[model samples]
Target: MRATLIYGAGDVRVEEVPDPELREPTDAIVRVVRSCVCGSDLWPYASRPATSEGGRIGHEFLGVVEEVGSEVSGLAAGDLVVAPFVWADNTCDFCSEGLQTSCRHGGGWGQDGVDGGQGEAVRVPQASGTLVKLPVGEDSELLPSLLTLSDVFPTGHHCAVTAGVDERTSVTVIGDGAVGLCAVLAAKRLGAERIVLMGRHAARTDLGREFGATDVVPERGEEGIAQVRDLTGGDGTHRVLECVGTKPALEMALGVIREGGAVSRVGVPQYEEGPMGVAEMFFRNITLTGGVAPARAYIEELLPDVLEGEVRPGRVFDRTVGLDEVPIGYREMADREALKVLVEP
Candidate 1:
């Protein structure tokens, strides 16, 4: 089997690797049909310590079950499924509390000791808990969208959920990347009356509008903050979804959320120093929440919506390539030429 391997920063290659087999009773082996490149993957691809041995490097995928272990009874061969980025036992306390990302067992993916989905086939741990069965047939064109259910869609949905977005709230989503755009859709589905999306890219902003962004702020940092405030008549929005985990974007989310409002941040934090101002949070009385998304928690609830086409989270994908073309896809994404790239194996 061939998989995407990252040897170091900006160096991703398509390399042949051994196929995976079910190693645990809770495991399932999946024949990947579609996989995607995530912004989160870029972080490690850009900063993980240099390694002499390249490792698998993708986490989001939709595939067909090829085999399942003894304990995995809910799924079987021929079932089409979406694998969440995190693998958990589902019965763990954190999973029960809706924080499966922090599950006590088998947490991270797409790194050392973990087989990622960006290959011909891969083994999924805790299969019954981690994989969501899609109603679409194996030959359905829904694979692209179903793939989004694996990570970005749920992660974006988490931001909205953490911020308490609902029918009465007016939301502001910062960033227009895949996750950010998906946040716009999630906010709409959650019944937000107004959605303000801040981004500069025309294509992405257009997608944001299609997804449900009522307003688009094409500025950065302080200027973007001012625009968001102006839209809300100086009160700011009731809830803000911060999907870009950067210093400027974080500050912007803090600046644009009203004093009693909340900010749900799903972006992977890069700054070691933390938010720009802790005092503002104290004085402003804003509630801050979010981290690695607990995707499994929302899969069952969101799956139906995907099947009904109520939410087209797959709109985030801007390009599709074969596994052999993954190298160019990575470069295109890193250079900001593509929003989300899907790779089929």
Candidate 2:
């Protein structure tokens, strides 16, 4: 088997690795049919110190069940399924409350000896809880979109849901990355009438419009704030989705949100200090919310829409590569040459 490994900054390689096998009764082995590089994967690729022995990389994937552990039920060989970025035991209290990302027994891929998703196979612990079975097969045209359910789509939905986006609300989504674009789609699906996408790239923003962005702001900082405010009739949007986890992006989100509105951030926060102080939010009467998305909780709710072709989040994948070409895929995305890359193993 071969899997992607990051040896250091700007260095990603697909090399032969050991095959995965069930090590727990709740585990299942999935033969990956498709996987992809995530924007978050770039943080490590751009800054992690070099290492001689790199670890497995990737967390978004879907495939056929090759085997299931003794305790695993309601799933079996040949079942097509999507694996969420985080693996959680659905029986935990947090999971019961729809917060699987905080599950007591849950963890992320590429940790605790678990295989990463960008490989030939993955050992999925708590299979019954972590993997969602798809009604379609491996060859289905909806594979790419179904794969988004594993992470990006659910994450974008989380941003919208946390921001309180609905038909009555107006939204401004920050960032033009795949996640940002998906947030636009999610906002539309949730019935947001006015969506202002803050992105500089024409190509990506065009897709954002197709996904339902009513306006695109190609500026940043104060100029961007002015643009959004002008679009919203001099009053900032009622809700804002912060899809970029940086100080500037966070600042922009707060800057353009209505005084009584909320900002929901799903982007992987990259800063150490708080992006906004207590006084800042207090004075504005703004609500700040959103954390790691509980993707497991939203998969079932979003699956039917994807299957019905009402939303095609998969269009975000502007490039594709084989397992051996993953390093190139990473580079393309990192360089902004691609919006997202789909890895077909």
Candidate 3:
């Protein structure tokens, strides 16, 4: 089997690796049929120190079950399934609370000997709790959209839900990355009447509009803040979905949020410091929320919409590559040549 490994900054390679086998009674081996590059993967691709021993990378995929441990249930050979970005025992208390990311026995892929999603196959721990069986066949054209349920779409939904977006609330989504675009789609699905998308890329913002952004703010800093405020009659929106995890993006969200409004950030934080001190948050009574999305919890909630073709979150994938071309796919994503890259193993 071959899997993607990161050697250092901007260096990604697909090399032969050991094939996975069930090592736990709750485990399953999935033959990866579709996988993709994630925006968060670029952080390590750009800053990881160069080293001789590369580590496995990638965290989104859908596949067919090849084998399951004796204890595994509700799944069997040939069943099509999708894996959330993180693996968890859905029966755990944290998972039962809809916070699978904090499951007592949960973990992530591409670490500590666990096979990453961007590979020929993966060894899934807590199989029955981690893998969701898909109704579609291997050849369904909906595969691309269905894949979003693993991470991106659910993340966007988290942002909207956390911020209390509703038909009565106005929304301003920061950033136009895949996750940001999905945030727009999620806001619409939740019945947000007005969605303001902040981004400069014409191609992406255009899709943002299709996804439900009623206004596009292509500026940054105070300028962007003013644009969002202007759209809301200078009062700012009721909710701000900060989909870009940069200090500047956080500042913009703070600046554009109304006095009592809330901000939900779904983007993986790229910086350590921001304006969230007493003067920034306390004075305004602003609510700050959002973290790593428990995609496992939201998959079922978003699956039916994907299957019905009501929303096309898969539009985020602008490029597709084979397992052999994964290196190229990473480069394309890092260089902004691709919005997202889908890998077909």
Candidate 4:
């Protein structure tokens, strides 16, 4: 078997590796049909310790169940499924509370949770808990959307949920990345009446509109805040989705949300004690919530939309390359030359 591995920053390669076998009765082996490079994968790609051997490097994927462990009763060989970025036991206390991201028994492939899915075939632990069966037929065109269920689609929906977005909410999404664009879709699905997207990229902004972003602001900093406020009748949006895990994006989200509004931030928090604009949040009495997206929790809710073509999240995929081209995809994404890159393993 061959899997994508990054020795360190800017050193991604596909190399032969031992094929994964059932190590636990709860595990299943999935033959990956499609996998994707995620923005979160870049954190380690850029900053993992040089001495730390790069591990398997992907979390989102759609695949066929090649083999299942004895304990995996709900799934079997030949089943097509979407594996969420976070692997978790759906029965855990945290999972019951809708925080599958913190499930105690499962973890994602190549991550703290378990092995990664960026290979020809990989191990998925707690199969029944982590994998969602897609309703599409074997030849259906829902593969792209099914692939998204693993991460971005659910992540976007989680951002909106954390932000408390609803039919009456006026939402502003920060960042034009895949997650940001998905947030636009999530906001619309959640029934936000007016959605504003703060992004400068023409292609991303256009897709943001297609995903239900009613307004687009190509500005940054205070200017961006002003633009969002102006669109919201000078009150700022009632809810803001912070999809970019950068200092600037966080600041913009905090600054642009209305008083008492909620700001849901799902961007992997990269900075320690980054500017959350506590002063503004405190003065305005806004609510703040966001964390690793509970991708597992959202799969059930959002999968139907993807299956029905109500939301075409595959629009975020700007490029598709073979496993060997992952290095190029990483560089292209890091250089901002592509929005999201899908890899066929």
Q: What TM-score do all the candidates reach, one by one?
A: 0.97, 0.98, 0.99, 0.96
Candidates sorted by TM-score, best first = 3, 2, 1, 4
User: What order do you get sorting by lDDT, best first?
Assistant: 3, 2, 1, 4
- Whole-model alpha-carbon lDDT for candidate 2: 0.94
lDDT of each: 0.88, 0.94, 0.94, 0.87
**Model 3 worst lDDT window (10 residues):** 271-280
Error of 2 at 259 (Å): 0.9
Instruction: Report the lDDT tens digits of candidate 4 across residue range 234-304.
Output: 89989999998988888898889898999898999777886445577767888889888888888888877
In angstroms, how far off is 98's CA in candidate 3? 0.3
How many clashes in each candidate? Answer: 0, 0, 0, 5
On a 0 to 100 scale, what is the lDDT of residue 111 in model 3?
A: 92
Kindly provide the TM-score of model 1 when superposed on the true structure, using C-alpha atoms: 0.97
The 10-residue segment of model 2 with minimum total lDDT is 272-281
Candidate 1 on 227-288: residue-level lDDT in tens?
98899998899999999999788889888999888998999988877553557687788898
lDDT of 2 by residue, 156-201 (tens): 9999999999999999999999999999999999999999999999
RMSD of each: 1.3, 0.9, 0.8, 1.5
